[model samples]
Target: MKRVFNKFLIQPKIVLSIFLLTSLIVLISALLEYNQSKKEINKLMENQSHTLLDAILISSNDAIKSYNLIKSEINQRLLNNAIFIKYLYENNLLTNSKLTQIAKENELFRINVFSKNGSRLFSSHPLSKFEQTFQNKSKEILKEIFNGEVDTLQIGIKESQLSNSYRYVVAVAAKDRSAIVINIDANKLVELRKESGFGPLLKKFTQNKNIIYLIFQNENGIIAASGNFKDLDDLNSSSFLQKSFNEEKFYSRIFETDSISVFESVNALIINNSKLGIIRLGLSTEPLDQIAQKIINRTIIQSIFLLVFGVITFSFLFIRQNYDSLSKKFRSIETYFKNIFDNVSDSIILFSNKLNIEAVNNSALELFNSKDKYELELNFNSFFVDLIKIDFTILEKEISINDQTKFLLISKTIFNDEAISNKFIFVIKDITHQKIIEKQNIRNQQLSALSDLSSSVAHEIRNPLNAIATITQQIGKDFTVNENENEFKQLTKIVYKEVKRINSIIESFLKFARPLPINTESFSLKEFFMQLKLQYQNIFNEKNILFNIQLNKDTQVKWDKFQIKQVFINLIENSIDAVNNNGTISVFAHEIDNKIEIKFSDTGKGIQEDILDKIFNIYFTTKNNGNGLGLSIVQKIINEHNGLINVTSKINNGTTFTLILPKVVEVKNV
Candidate 1:
C-alpha cells in the first residue's frame, strides 16, 4: 500500500499538469476581478465628483445671492438719505459744509447738487476734475429724469473704468428746479463678497488633505481662492479648467502639474438666471489611485491562495481516483528501476531526443546538491555546457559550481527501444579529490626539480661572483691610475658593480626555489593594518598619494603573518612605482564563505593585457631594475597557504589585486 501511494505521489508530470491548469484558472479569475474592481472604483469616484460639484454650486449660488442683496440694501439706504438731504438743503436747513458732513457720516464718496437746467450747483469732492466729470454725467441723467416726469428720486449704480471701483449714484429733484446727488462707495461690497461668500465654504471643503484647491472666477478675474494660491494663473490657463468653463456644465478632469496630480471639477455658478462665474474645486486623485492599487493587491493575494488550494485539492482527487489500477503495474517497474538507480554511486541522467532532461536518479540530485530533478534541469545548461558540447563516447573535464571545483568523468549511451528511442543516458562520476591529489603531486615533482637546479646553480655561481668582485675591487685600489689611466679604473669599477648585481640575482633565485617555514598565528586584522599604515605613511606622504583602509570589522585571522605581510608589501611597492604623484591607494578586507578576502587597489598606470598573465612567473620583470622574483615568491607563498590571488588591470585606469585566504588555519607544527 505504501509503495502504491508513493508511486502516485511522485509522478511529477501529473502534479505539474494540475498546477498549470489551476494557475490558468486563477489568473483568469484574478484578471476578471481586477477589471471589475477598477470599474467599481471609477464609478464611485465619478459619482463623488458629481456630488461634490453640486454641493459647491449650491453653496456658491447662495453666496452670490447674499452679496447681491447686501448691495441692494446699500443702494436703497443711500438713495433715501440723498432724497431727505436734498429736502433739507432746499428748505435752507443745510449748507455745503453740512452736506459734506452728511456725506462723510454716511460713508458716501462724493455729493453733488445739480440744477434742473443741467448746471452744477455745489460739490463736496476734493478733486475739482472728478467733480466736473460727475457734473457732466449728471446733466444727461437729469435730462432723462425731467423729461420722463418720474417720481421723487432716481438712483443708479455704475463702475468707474479708471479705478475699477463701483459707485452708487442718487439724484433727488426737490421741485425747486435743482437736483441733489450723492455718490456712495461700493468697493466694500466686493470685499464683503470675498471675505464671507467663498472663503468659508472653500475652507470647509479643503479641510480634507486631498482637496488641492478651490477657486471662484468671473469676467473680472479670480474673486476668491483657497489653497495654494501661488500659481493661480497657471490653474486658470490649464486646458482642463478651460474645458470646464467652455462646456458650462458639471465637468471633472485630471491634470498633472510639476509636483502633483490634480483632479478638478468645474461647475457654473448660476444665480437669478445668470452665470456669474465658475466654481472650480480641485482634488488630488492619489487616494482614488490607492484604492485601485489595494483592490489589485487583494485580488492577486486571493488568487494565489485559490490557486494553491485548488491545485492541492484536484491533485488529491486525481490520485485517489486512479490509484487502484496503476498500483500493481507501476509498482514492479518502479521497484526495479529504483533499486538500480539508488544503489549506484555514479549519477545517472536521462535526456530526451530534444535535449530536455527526462529523469534524474538520487545520485544525480545529491551530486548537484539539488532538492529535486527540477533544479538540476534548470541549471544543467549553464553548469554543464562544456560537457554537452563534447561529442565523444567518454569525456572527462574539470568544472566549477558555487566555488567548488570538480573533475567529472562522463559516459553517454544511446537507446533505440521503441518507447525511449533516440534518447541518451549519461553517467557522471565525481573525481574532484582524486584530481586535486594528482595535480598536487605533479606540482610537487616540478618544485622539487626546480629547487635542486636552483641550489646547484646558486652554489656554483656565488663563489665565482664573489671572487670576481674582490679581484675587480683590488685592481681598482692597488693600480691607482693617473688621468691617462682613468678609463681602466672606470672599467674595474663597472666590473665590481656587475659582480655584485649577479650575486643579488642568485640570492633572489634561491629564495624563490626554497620552501619557507610558516608560523600560523591568530592575529587581529585591524592591528595588522595599523602597523602597515605606520610603516608606509612616510612614503605615501612624500609622494602626495592618499591611502585608505576599510574593514568590515576587526576580525581574527589565522595565517602566517610574516609571509602575508611580505606579499602585500611587494604589491604596494609595485603600485607606488606605477603611480604618478598625487594618486590614491586603498585596501579593503572582508570575510565571505569562510574565507578572508583582501584587496589592494591603486590609481596607477595599469599593466598591459598581454603581459598581465605572466606577472607571477619567475624572472619576468617589466621594470628596468626589477629582479622579478618578488611576485613569483609571493605566488608560491600563497599557494602553500592554500589561498588564491587574482589581478585585474585596465590601461590608464588602474589595477586591483585580490587575495583570498582561508579564515581558519589548523595548528600544525612543521
Candidate 2:
C-alpha cells in the first residue's frame, strides 16, 4: 500500500489533480471565514466607540451645569450684601468673601469682580495690577455678561504638557453693574473617566495577527483612553477642540503592517445638546485567524478520511510513469546565469538605452555609491556631478576630458529602428584632485598678471606726478603780495590745491603697488592703543569729538605692527571724516572666540544704502577731495594677512567698520 501511494504521488496527472482540488477547497474556506470574522470585529469595535462618545456628551453637560450654578450663587451674594451693593453704586471695599464664596462652592481656582462701570474692584487671585482686562478676548465675553446677555459664560482652559493645572472660567453678571468669574479644573472629568482596557486589546490583536487597535474621543480625537497608538500630537490645541464643537463627523483610513485601520467617527450624543465624547475603535485580523484555524482543522480530518479510498483507486495507474530529466537541467542553467548577473564587480545594467535597469550586480551599489537600486533610477542627470568627469548637455555625441578624446560607443544592432540593444556603454573615472589643481594654477596666473600691470603703471605715474607738483609749487612762489596782487594769489592757491589732490591720487597708487611688508612679531594691543591715544589727544580736543579705544589687556598678536598701524590709521581717518565736531569715534580691539577683532565706529553721517556695495570697490568715493583707495588698500592688506573686513552702516545713525584677523601664537624669544 505504501509503494502504491508513493507511485501515485510521483505521477504527473495524479499530482496535478490533487494540488488543484486542495487549492480550490482552501480558497473557498478562507473567503467565507474572512467575511464572518470581519463582521464580528467591526460590531465589537463600533459598540465600544459609541460608549466613548456617550462619555463626552455627559462631561460637556456636567461642565456647563456646574458653570451656571456657580454664577447664580455669586450674583445672589452680591445682591444681598449692603456694602457690595453700595460699592457697586460707589467705590469702596466689600468683603473678599464676596468673590471667595462662589470660587469655593464650585471648586474654582480664582474669582474676579468687575464693577458695572468697567472698574476691576477686587480679585480672589493676586494678579498684575496693570493687566489690561479689555485687551484680551476673555474680556469681550466678560463685557457681554456685564450687559446681562448671559446668565453665565462657560470657558474651557487649554491643555499644556508643561503644566498640570488645567482650568475653565465661568463668568456671571446680573442687572446690577457687578460681575463675578469662577475658575474650575478642565481636566478633572477627562481624568475621572479614562478607560484603561485599550492596552490589553491592542496586545491581544497584535499577538493574533500583528494588528493595532486605537480609540479616539470627540473632545480629544486621538486621546485614546486605552490603546497602543501614539498621541494625537498633530491636532492643534484650540482649533482641533473647536472642530468637535462645529463638525458632526469625520473619518480616516490608514494602513498598518498586515492590516488596515478604518476610522469611523460619529458624534456621541448622550442627550439633546449634550455630548459625551468621540470613540474610535479598531478591528483587526485576529478573529480571522481563529476562524481560519478551525476551518483548517476540519479540512484535515476530512482529507484523512478520503485519502484511503483515493490512494487505492490511483496507485496502480501511476506505478509505471517516468520523470523528465530536462526540467532539472533548465533550472540549473537559469540559476547559473542569475548568479553571474548578480555577482559582477561593475554594475551590468543592460538596459535598452531607454535606461531601464534590466540587470544589476551586487558591486553596482558600491560603484555607484548607493545602497538601493531605486536610488539609481533618477538617472545620470541627478547624481552625474558626483561620478562623471565633466558636465555637458546630454544629447552631445562626443565629450573630451582633459583634452583626451573618448568615443561614446553605441550598439549598432537594430531592434525595430532602435540600435540593437540600443545600448550605450559610458564609464566614469574620478578626476577631482587633478581638476582642483588645474583651477588653482589658472587663478594664480591671473593674479600674477594683475600684480605686474599694477606695479609698472604705478611707477610710471609717480614720476609724472612729482614733476607736476614741483612745477605748481614753483609757479605759486613766482607771484608777489599787494591789493591788486591778491586776486592773482588766490588763483595760484587754487592751482596748488588741485595739484595736491593729484599728488594724493599718486600716493594711493604707490600704496597699492607696493604693499607694506608684514613684520610679524608679538605686540601688546593694549599698549599700542595707549600710544595712539596720546598721539591723537590734541586732535580730539580740537574737534571736541571723544576719541576712545577699548583694548583687551591680555590680547597680543604676531603681526607686522607698521602695516597694521597703517591699516588702522586709514580706518581712523575715515571715521574722523564721517563724524561732526561733537560726535565720537570709538575704537575697540579684543580677542573674541579665537579671532582678533578691531572695530572703528563713528557717530556721524553713515554711508548710504545705495552706495555701500561700492565702498569696497577700487577708486570709488563719496567724500569731496577723497582718493577712495584707503578702504580698498585696507581690504587688500587684511586679505594678505588672511583676515576679513565687514562694515555695518545705517544712514544718519552711524557707521561701524570691523576687521577680523585670525589669532596667531606668539613664539617665545628664549
In Å, residue 301's CA in model 2 sits off its true spot by 53
RMSD of each: 19.5, 23.3
TM-score of each: 0.40, 0.28
Q: Which one wins on lDDT?
A: 1
Evaluate model 1: give its TM-score: 0.40
Query: Which residue pairs collide in model 1, if any?
Result: none
How far out, in Å, is residue 281 in model 2?
Answer: 75
Give the per-residue lDDT of model 1 (tens digit) for 462-561.
9988999999999988886667588998899999998998898788768767777888989999899889888999999999988889999999998999
Best by TM-score: 1
Q: What's the CA error at residue 71 for candidate 1, in Å?
A: 74
Taken over the whole model, the C-alpha lDDT of each candidate is: 0.77, 0.57
